[model samples]
Target: MNRTLIPLAMALILCLLAATAPAADSHPGWFGVIADPGALTIRNGVAGRLSEYTVAIGDPVRPGQIVARIDPEQAAAQLAQMQAQIDAAEAELEGKKATTNSLQERLERILTRPDALSSGALAEMRGNLRTARAETRAAEARLAQQIQERELTRGKIAKTELRSPIQGHVVEYLANVGADLSTDAAVVRLRSAQPLVLRFAFDPRDAAAPSVGTRIRVQEDRSIGAPGNDTRSHTATVESLAMIVDEDSG
Candidate 1:
């Protein structure tokens, strides 16, 4: 019985030694993290068929750069129609003004030579002059209304252009050329190029997790197991921390 107990006691000692031993070549404070800029979806402000698609996945974009265009032909045509109406209205207004002036001249002539016309004829001439002036005012109002509509059509044409809101690379095309899009519809997705952020997960119980404003140095792990590979390093500051604990990690 003594000999059998000795072997079991030796086995327990070996297990303890293994559990306490430090892992080989492990570096302290080393953790894996990912670096990337977040994505943004670009949307259209007006509804129309896409006439131009000027970007694809992985294409670099600049702020205010035109990435797509909705077809402006409809708006342009509407504007043309409005302009024609305005022109016709202007011509009609001019004609009415000419008639009003001619009637005013005839009334003045009769007033200066009162005996040249009878009282009934004079009264009728005054009534005709008033009617002509009213018609002229109505024509002027119609012209003003047409001009306002033309300006509105011009505004619609301006909204057909779709531009990138930031400096980034395109990640996706939500709508393709010739596709009909509605107002506020997403046209493409982009990943921002500036201010790259580093993200990593850690145990919730860890007291050493970096807080906001803490500076950190990140080293690439590409050199691991490679004889002559050079490791890259980047410096960053912690800007935020997740408020909710990750259930799987925690």
Candidate 2:
């Protein structure tokens, strides 16, 4: 009976030591999901049949990179027509300027002529000069209008080419080559190569733990063994913490 009591006493002491020993601290902020801000869903601002697709999924993209082109046949035609109009207007303006210069030269010669008191002829010459000057000014204004119209047409022609707005990876092509697209139709999808953020939902009771500068580890799914293994998953620090409990989840 004494021997049995001694063994039981030893077991009790072992249990006490085990209970007093240091153990891993539990973190309630463990539950988290990755997030990305550079995930882009591209769309066409103009409507037309897709004429070309210059990129594919998983392709790297740069800002202002041309990713696709819509049918530009109509836009190009308008641009050409506007350009021709501008050319014609410019030619007319040059002709008007030349005529105005010639009329001014003739008026100067008439003024310098030795014949004095020719009031009637002088009045007629002055009237013809004013008419030429007015016509020249009108031609100048028309030329300016034509230039503006041509620039507008050029802008429309540029819209047919779709370009990426951000530098990132191409995730998908929503619209295929030769596919018809309406305004605001999605064209391509892209995401940044930068590291993604992890959002964790911490319990309200453990709110004090998730504070700014709190070091944390991000673990990948155990089934995949893709990250947090030999390669090791990315670790991060808490940048911010919510003070108020989420009403929707609560």
Indicate which candidate wins on lDDT.
1
Scanning candidate 1 in windows of ten residues, the lowest lDDT window is 4-13
- List candidate 2 stretches off by more than 4 Å: 1-35, 45-47, 114-118, 179-185, 195-202, 206-240, 245-250
**What are the TM-scores, per candidate, against the unseen true structure?**
0.63, 0.63
- Across 105-163, the per-residue lDDT of candidate 2 in tens digits comes to 98898788749538898888788889989999999898888888888767766888889
What overall lDDT, based on C-alpha atoms, would model 2 receive against the true structure?
0.70
lDDT value, residue 205 of candidate 2: 46
**Which regions of candidate 1 fall more than 4 Å away from where they truly are?**
1-40, 191-208, 212-237, 240-250
Give per-residue lDDT, candidate 2, residue 172. Answer: 84
For 65-115, candidate 1 gives per-residue lDDT tens digits of 888889998888889989988999999999999999999998998899979
Error of 1 at 40 (Å): 4.8
**Whole-model lDDT per candidate:** 0.73, 0.70
